[model samples]
Target: MRKHHAQQLYDYHVWANDKFFARLKELPEDIYIQEIQSVFPSIAETLVHMYMVDTIWLGVMKGNSMAEIQASIASVQEITKDNQLQKMEKLFQDLSAEYQTFLHHESDLDKEISPEHPQFGRLDTQLSELVQHVVNHGTYHRGNLSAMIRQQGYASVANDYVFYLYEGKAEK
Candidate 1:
């Protein structure tokens, strides 16, 4: 079977996220939880947010109700409350695996899904578009993570999609 565009983008998303997480592991453990005045309170919190949002969207894509998604998010918050780096990394890995399974089985990337929001009203969109949004959202947060790392006087990893392509070529 041919790979869908959404799946390809999701593959890049996973690759970039993994690269960033590995770099985070190389930094001082304390830096992961150091409080910073930015989009999020700390690197740990930011990562947790990313993971939670990813989980929520995955649930949405799976046709889960909002209440179910909220419950799942609450569970994630409890699991990541301590802001431990390893715990957060594990959650991300697990979620990525889940996403992989979902993408593998999904047959209709262009299927329209109507997801209603309390504040934003309703969005009528395709599954592939939602997947793209998730990737874009992650890219934005990774940029925030990069700046936060620099603010802490640490080097950030290069996770650009072009690099992902080049790396694949090199491995070939």
Candidate 2:
């Protein structure tokens, strides 16, 4: 994939994330932390998981091992919906900037990354593929978050890629 393509995908990822977070904020604070039976136990846990995965992929792109990335975000164990939105927002901003910078500087889309997973061992993949995976991963969890919101009797935000396109975001 081209850098511009990855950039557009990342742009949409950020926009969608913001829209989801806005809707999440509209709910009563207690709902954010309420445990439910899903991919994650609660909206807050799902959001934190998304942020942590993004950080992991970003760390891998920067040449850090998965173990290293996990170690870095270990402090997040104590984070909760009650006390972590501000910090998570900062992470969102920083990761977005880092992604944009990575796209700007990398000339090769085919460069390989083989981040080691402790349980699964190592799998070789292209940089551009991983970039796409990160966006897809976020989209999936955001859908989960939406379901959790509705389970709490609140309306969730629409963050579909079509909506992002209809907002006049540049496609090229």
Candidate 3:
């Protein structure tokens, strides 16, 4: 079962992202959106970029039109709202649902997807890798987001996978 391992990883990632963002909301709005020394431009912009790119890659892996994912995110960047916390929740929810559907439909663990990455060139990867990459990608930016927020003097909860495993509901 390739699917089992991949799904397990996906479950862990969804668990981690949800908890991470929930704690992220505790930080003041200004701090969360603030620019500081980060892996990306600003915490806010990077977070948007993370979700957008992830959907693109995931869409490509699942044979979904990457354009839809691109357009969905391009719409958000045009005008980010003040209620960013709500927006983040929506993004997470959508990603969670999409990934869940992907897992269910892709029951074959050995399935392969070869997609060309603009930066990395062509990638011949397992579905497991694609699923894991999105989670890892999001977590990296979430870390960037946390650090950026704290640089402006805001506190954040630890959003690690181990923390989620010990503390939160994982089956949802």
Candidate 4:
């Protein structure tokens, strides 16, 4: 896809994440750290993983080592210990701002980036592909969040791409 299309997708990703996170904030604080049987163990873990992975990809794009990326965000203990939700909100806000600035200066979506992960091996892909992967990755885990929310007897927010579009954010 084109860089503009990728930017739109990333914008939608941020919009959807905000909707889900806002809904999460309405729930009792304990529910976020409560252990549950799901993809990532608990709501807090899932959210933290999303932030970590997003940071990793963005860091790689910016030419940082994995160690640098991991050190940039809060530790796993801090995220699950106290003020977990607030920490996540701040993390996403910071990451989203950096992502927007990166995109604004980006003009070569077709440029190839080879980022390696110890477990996932190495990827040889275009920058646009990495951007799309970030969007898709968030969407998948947001579904997990929806299920987790339902398990807690609460309704999750609507975070569909169409919903974002209908909200007129797609025009931005």
Candidate 5:
């Protein structure tokens, strides 16, 4: 079957995240947890935030209740307590695989969902839109991650969508 627009964007999101995480792992190990005065305290903390949000959204997409979502987030928090970048990367990869499986089996990309949030009130949107929001959220934080790396005088990887496209073509 042909891919939906949201699925394509999600694919790009996973590819881009993998690229950034791989580059992050290549840097000095300390760099991952190095204290920084930014939106987040450190790269490790920022990654944890990214991972938590992704987990929350995935739970939401799967029709999980708020309690279940909170549980999922708490579980991830436990994993991040050690501040290990490798563990964080593995979490991302595992979550990405889950999303891949979800998208693969999802038959209705536009199915309407009403998920109420404590702060944002309620969102009445389609599954596809929620997927898009997740991708956008990831992109925004990846930018923050890139800047954090630069602030520490480290080079950041290029994870633009066009690069993902180019790499796909090159691999064929």
Candidate 6:
């Protein structure tokens, strides 16, 4: 089912993340940190936004309240790259773990779970939808971050999911 693709995407997503961060680290730190993009404002902001969406989506999937989700996002925002790569890796790991858990524990991926999204209002979603949400959301903001790197005169790695799958190995 969708869980198979979800499992594959977990690997792809993390590979892309490692590639993105490697490119970031390769860039001159000052330019990497200073190059500002309107969409994300800064590379740091883009990274934080990715983790925020993770928290938001993961919380909802865990049956946590919107209020609790917001708190999770706030805490994620405080995590700077230097401050928490180990922790970030764990969150990325959890993304895969949680997805697997939901796949097994739930009787059906199509079952509607309508949870109140604080900003989006009522959202009737499937487990599949949440998996899709994180993949699509991560890809979008990672693109923003990649563009920022290119704008700063750096070559960005291929972060497309297809690219990641075809490559079959994480870079760095």
The digit string of per-residue lDDT tens for model 5 on 6-93 reads 8888999988888888998789988888889888999888889988998999999999998999899789888879868777888889
The most accurate candidate by lDDT is 1
lDDT of each: 0.89, 0.80, 0.70, 0.84, 0.88, 0.69
Cα miss at 112, model 4 (Å)?
A: 2.0
Q: Could you estimate the TM-score for every candidate?
A: 0.94, 0.86, 0.79, 0.86, 0.93, 0.78
lDDT accuracy of residue 135 in candidate 2: 95
Model 6 spans with C-alpha error above 4 angstroms? 1-3, 80-110, 169-172
By descending lDDT, how would the candidates be arranged?
1, 5, 4, 2, 3, 6
- The lowest-lDDT stretch of 10 consecutive residues in candidate 5 is 163-172
| Predicted candidate 1, C-alpha RMSD | 1.9
Ranking by TM-score: 1, 5, 4, 2, 3, 6
Give per-residue lDDT, candidate 4, residue 125.
88
RMSD of each: 1.9, 2.5, 3.2, 2.7, 2.0, 4.0
Clashing pairs in 3: none
Taking the tens digit of each residue's C-alpha lDDT, what string does model 6 give over 114-165?
A: 8886577988777667867787888888888778878877788888877775
Off by over 4 Å in 1: 169-172
RMSD of 3: 3.2
Residues 26-118 of candidate 3: C-alpha lDDT, one tens digit per residue: 666666566676677566677677766766766787765546656765665663554376786787678778878878887684588787655
Off by over 4 Å in 2: 1-3, 78-83
